[model samples]
Target: MAPEPTSPVAGEQQDRSGETQDPATYEITKPLDEESPLLSPTRDEEQEGLIEDGSVHHDRDETSETKPLWYMILLTISIGGLQLAWAVELSNGSPYLLSLGLSKSLMALVWIAGPLTGTIVQPYVGILSDNCRSSWGKRTPFMIAGSAATIISLLALAWVREIVGGFLGLCGVDRESEGVKVTIIVVAVLFVYVLDVAINTVQAGIRAFILDCCPSHQQEAANSMASRVLGVGNIIGYVAGNIDLPKHLWFFGNTQFKVLCVIASLALGSTVALSIGTVRERDASLEGPPPKGRGGLIAFFKQVFKSIRRLPPQTRKVCEVQFFAWVGFFPQLFYSSSYIGDIYVQPFLEANPNMTPEEIDKLYEKATRVGTFALLIYAITSLATNVFLPFLIAPSYDSPANASLRAQRGQHTRLSRFLDHLVIPWLTLRRAWLIAHLIFATCMFSTLFVRSVGGATALIGIVGVSWALTLWAPFAIISAEISKLEEVRRLRASSPDDNNNNNTTDQAGIVLGIHNMSVSSPQIFATVGSSIIFKFLQKPRGTPGDHSIAVVLAAGGLSTLVAAFLTSRIQDEVEIPEGVVVEEGLAAFGVLSS
Candidate 1:
C-alpha cells in the first residue's frame, strides 16, 4: 500500500475544495483514474486518495492553474535586465583587467571561470529547487536573494577598481601601475564570480518554477515563451548597455552601472514575487524547511542523487544527447567575440597599415556594433521560427486531423503523424537543416582567414542571417514534437481500462533542466577548452591562433551533423507510451484491416 497522506497534504486539498468537510472524513466515491490530474505532478502526491472501482475519476482540471501573464512579463523583464548588465560588463568591464595589467592568459582564466560555474552549479541549483520546501515557495526566496547579491556585487566591482587605483597612487606608483593593482582586481573579480553564481542560481530556480506551474500539454508553448523572453531580454539589455551618453560621460561610468544594477535587482525581486504570489503551493509537505540534523544535508544530497539516478530511461537518453550536444557547442561562447575581434577587426587593421591605431579603434568599434546588431537579428529570427514550426508537422493543419489534435489537446497539434513531411522547408529537410547550420558555422568561422573588413563583414552578415533564420525555431519544434508524444502517453494512461495513468509532471522539470544542461555544458567546455587552445595560437607566441580556433569551430559545426543523425535514432523512442489510445487505435485498425 502507498504511504498515508500527511496532514499538510490533507489541509491543502481541503482549502482547494473551499472549506469542505475534512478530507480525512470525506468519502472517495470516484476512483482516481489515470487521466485525473494530480494536485501536484510529483508521484508522491498522486496516491493520496482513490475511489471504488465503479467510480468515475474527476480531476480538478489542470487548465485553471496559471500565474497571470503580467507576472510572466515581469519575470521576463527582470531576467532581461540581469542579462543586459552582464553582457555590458562582459564587453566593457574587461578594460579594468587590461588597465590593471593582468596577462592575457590570466584574463582568459578568469573568463573561463564563469562558464565553469554554469556547467555544474546550475544543475545543482535546479535539483535543489526541485526538492525545495518553503512557505515562500521553493524558488522565489532564492530568486530574490540572488538578485540582491547581484546588485551588491556589481557596485562592489566598480568600487574595488577605484580603491585599487587609489592604493596604487598612495604607494607612489602613479603611472603605469597596472602590475601593482593585480591583487585588488583579482579580489574584485572573485566577488563578481560570486555574484554571477547567485544570479545563475535564481535563473535556474525560475526555470524550474515555470515548469512547475505549466501543464505538460502547455510546456511547448511555455518553452517557446521562455526562448522569446530570453532573446528579447538580451536584445533590450544589449541596446540599453550600449546607450552612449555623450552629455554625461562621468555618470556613465560606475554610477550609471550601479543604477542599472539597482534596477535589475528590483526588477528581478518584483518579478519573482509576482510570479509566485498569486500561485498556490499545493504540496503541503513542501511548505516548510526539511527536518533539522547533520543528516539533513546528506539526506538532501541522497534524495537529489536518487532523483537523478531513478529518472526514466527516456529521460536518461535525453540527458546523454544533451551532454553530447553541449560539448560540441561550448567553444562558441568565448570564441564569438574573439572571433569578431581577430578575424575581422585585427585583420582589418593589420592589412591597412597606413591607418593609425586611433583610426582602427574607431573603425573597429563601428564594426563591432554592426556585429552586435547581426546577433540581435539572429535572436529575433530564432523566436519567429519557434512559433511557426509546429504547424508544419504531419498535416497538423488539415481539417481531418483535428480529432487527433483535440484528443492530444495538450500536445498542441492537429495530426498524429505531424513528423511525416514538414511544410515550409519540408519535414524531410529537418536533418538537412542541422547539417547545413554546422556547415554554415564552420564556413563562417573559417572566414577568420580572410584579411579584409569588407569580406569579413559580408561573412558575418551571412552567418548571422542564416543562424537567425532558424536557431530558436528548430529547438522549439523538436521540443514540441517530443512533448506532444509525451502528452499522448499521459492521455493513454488516463483511460479507464488502463492501470498506468501516471502523473508524469516531475519529469518535465528534470527533462528541461537537462535540455538546458546540454546547452550550457558545451559553453563551459568550449569556453575553457577554446581559451586554452587559443592561448597556444595567440600572436607572437603561436602561429595564427585565431585561424586555428576558427578551423576547430568549423570542425565543431561539422560534428553537429553527427548529433543530427543521432537525433533520428532518438526520434523513434519518443512515441506514446504503451496502451496509449493512439497506439491502441492503430493496433485496432490493423486488426480490422486484416
Candidate 2:
C-alpha cells in the first residue's frame, strides 16, 4: 500500500544490518506507558545536534532537509557584520553630519537616503537575486559585490573631508574656502547614499539566502541565531563607538570617526568573506534567467505588483506591523545617541555659563561618547535576551500535539513547565510581539521624563528587550508562513490528480523585499516628518531648555502604541495538514524537541 524508500535521504546511512536508518528515528520496544528515554530525545542532545551538527534528517527534498548547525551558523553570521556597520552609522552618522556643518533638520533630511535606497534597492536586488543564474549562486555574487561596495563607501565617507581638501588643493583652490566645505558635504552625502544602496543589497541577499537554505521546521531557530549574531555585532560596534578610538588606535586614523569606519570595514569584510567562502549556495541557474528586452521588464514589474497584491494574510499582517514598528524604530535608530548626548551636555552648559566655543564642543563630543555607552548597554541587553529568552517561551507555529508530547516525555523544567501550562498558552508569538511594542512605547514616552544621562541610558537599555523581539518575531512568523506555502506547493506537485499548474510558490526574496519595503517606506515619511519636527522644535545651538529630541521620541512612542494594537489583531495560529508535525518543540521560541 506504501511506496518503499528508494535511495537514502540526506542523513540516512546503511547500518551494520545493511538497511538504511533515519538518523532522527530510534527503535522503541517498550510500551508507551513505560518510562523510556526512547519516548523523546533529550533537549540538550537535540540542541547539541542543532548547534554542533548532531545527526538529524528531514525529507529528501532539499528545501525540507535540516542543515548542520555549523552550516546554519555560517549562513547567518555575516548579518552580524551588516548589523555592526548599521550600528556604527546609527550611533555616529548624525554627529558626523553635524560636524560636516549640517543643521539638525538637514541631518534628518540626509537620513532620507537610507529609506530611499532601501525602498528601491532592496526590492530590485531581491528580484535580481531571485532570478540570477550566476555560477557563484544567486545570493553569493550579490553578497560579495555589495560587501565590496559597502567597504569602499564606508572608507569614502570617513575621509570625505580629506578627500575633498586634497582634490581642491590639486585644483588650486583654497582648502578652507566655502566652496571646499560645500564640496565636502556634498561628497559625504553621496557616499552615505552609496553605502545605503550597498548595505540594502547585501541585506536582501543574505535574508533570501537564509530562507532558501533553511527548511520550514528550522526557520525560527535560524532567525533566532541570526538575531543573536546581530546583537553581538551591535555590541561590538557600540563598544567601538563609545571608546575614544583615536586615542587607543591611532594607526587606524587620527579621528574617532575615521577609526570607527576602518573597524566597521574590517568587520564587514571578514564576516562576508567567511560566510561566502564556507557556505555552498545552491545554483539558481535551474530556476531560469530573467526576461530580456522592454517587454520582459514590463512583465517583471507586473509580476512584482501581482505578488504584492496576492500576499498571504499572515505576511500582510507582518508587513502592517513592520510599517508602524519601523516608524517608531527610526527615531531611536537615528537619534537615541544624539538625544542622550544632548541630555548629558545640558548640565555642563548650565554649569559653565561662559564656556568657550571650543570647550563646549569638546564637552558635547564627550557627551556623545557617553551616549554611545548607553547604546552599548542596549546592545548587551538585546544579546542576552536573544540568547536566553527562547528557552523560556514556546516558538511560533508549534502544534498542541508537540507540546503534549514534550510534557509526556518530561522535557520541560519547572519554570518552563509553569510557563507552558499557565503563561505561554496565552503568550503566543503575536501577543509577545504586542507586549514588545507596548514596552517600546513605554520606554519612548519615558524619554520625556528623563533629565539625567543615567536615566536616558537606563531607558535605552530597557528598549533593548523590545528590540530583540522585534528582530526575531516578525521574521520568524513570516518565514514560517513562507515555509507553509512551500509545503503546499510540494504537496500539490506530488498529487497525481492535481492539475493546478498556476500555483507557483512565492519566492522568499520577493516576499522579504515586500517586507523590507513596508519597513522602509514608512521611514521615508518618518524622516520627512522628523525633519519638519526638528525644523519647528529644534532650538539654536545654545538654547538652554530645548526638548526637540524628546518631542520626536514621544511622537515615535505614539506610533509604537498603534503598532501594539495592530500586533494584537494578527492571527497567531494557522491550521496545517492533519498529522503534519514539527519535530522541534515550542514553535515560536525554537525550543529543542523533547
Q: Which stretches of candidate 1 lie over 4 Å from their true place?
A: 1-59, 62-78, 89-104, 166-176, 241-305, 351-370, 387-445, 448-521, 540-549, 572-594
**Model 1 alpha-carbon miss at residue 161, Å:** 1.6
Cα-based lDDT for every prediction: 0.46, 0.75
Task: Single out the weakest 10-residue window by summed lDDT for candidate 1.
Answer: 36-45
Candidate 2, pairs of clashing residues: 49-54, 394-589, 395-586, 395-587, 395-588, 395-589, 396-587, 396-588
| Tens digit per residue, CA lDDT, model 2, 195-222 | 9999998899889877766766677778
Show the colliding residue pairs in model 1: 35-494, 326-522, 330-522, 330-526, 331-526, 386-473, 393-418, 394-418, 422-427, 442-554
Give the residue spans of candidate 2 off by over 4 A: 1-63, 288-301, 400-423, 487-503, 575-577, 580-594
Predicted candidate 1 versus true structure: per-residue lDDT over 1-594, tens digit per residue: 111111111221233345554333433222111111101111111222221111111133432233345544543444554555555455444434534455445565676556566655566666565446655555666667766776677666656756676777788876355564666767777976887687677676666555444443334445545655655655654454344423345553434344445444555566556655654333423333332424345654554454455444444444554455444454443344444545555555556657765675466455445445444444454445434544443221122233343355454333423442334333422343454356455554566566554555455444543343233334433343334333433333333443331232233334445455555666665556555765766553111233654654555565455555554554322322222332232222121111
By how many angstroms RMSD does model 2 differ from the true structure? 7.8
TM-score for each candidate, following the candidate numbering = 0.67, 0.83
